[model samples]
Target: MSAPKIKCPTCTRVIEYSDQYPHRPFCSERCKLIDLGEWASEKHKIEGNSIYDDLLSDDLEQPD
Candidate 1:
């Protein structure tokens, strides 16, 4: 059997999904870092409220 192929999430570069590619889903460190930057900068976000949202609201509502 051959290694499975996948596209890098950042650049959409087709790559082999195997140990040879350390950044399997990304193709290179650059692409991996780019994706990380997007998340760190809030460019990418999961669609839904975070659990901490309720906790933070509760904290704000309490008298200090």
Candidate 2:
């Protein structure tokens, strides 16, 4: 009998199922935690210019 192999999402490393991988998708626990922390801190954000920034002009002056 043989186990299946999987790829690590962080480094794209080929890992064997029998390696007792605690982190399934990642090759190591460190990589897994790094990815987890990224999500926790809201680091994964949508790429694009902010609409609010465009709507608000810095050059606009208020009447005294």
Give the best candidate by lDDT.
Answer: 1
Model 1 ranges with Cα > 4 A deviation: 56-64
Assess candidate 1 and give its lDDT.
0.91
Estimate, for each residue in 1-64, the C-alpha lDDT of model 2 and write its tens digit: 7778888877889887775887786889988988888888988777886888766867657568
Q: Cα lDDT for residue 62, model 2?
A: 52
Best candidate (score: TM-score): 1
For candidate 1, list the clashing residue pairs, or say none: none
* Candidate 1 weakest ten by summed lDDT: 55-64
How much is 54 displaced in model 2, in angstroms?
26
Candidate 2, residue 7: Cα displacement in angstroms equals 0.8
Indicate the residue-level lDDT of 13 in model 1: 89
lDDT of 1 by residue, 1-64 (tens): 9999999999998999999889878899999999999999999999988888977875666765
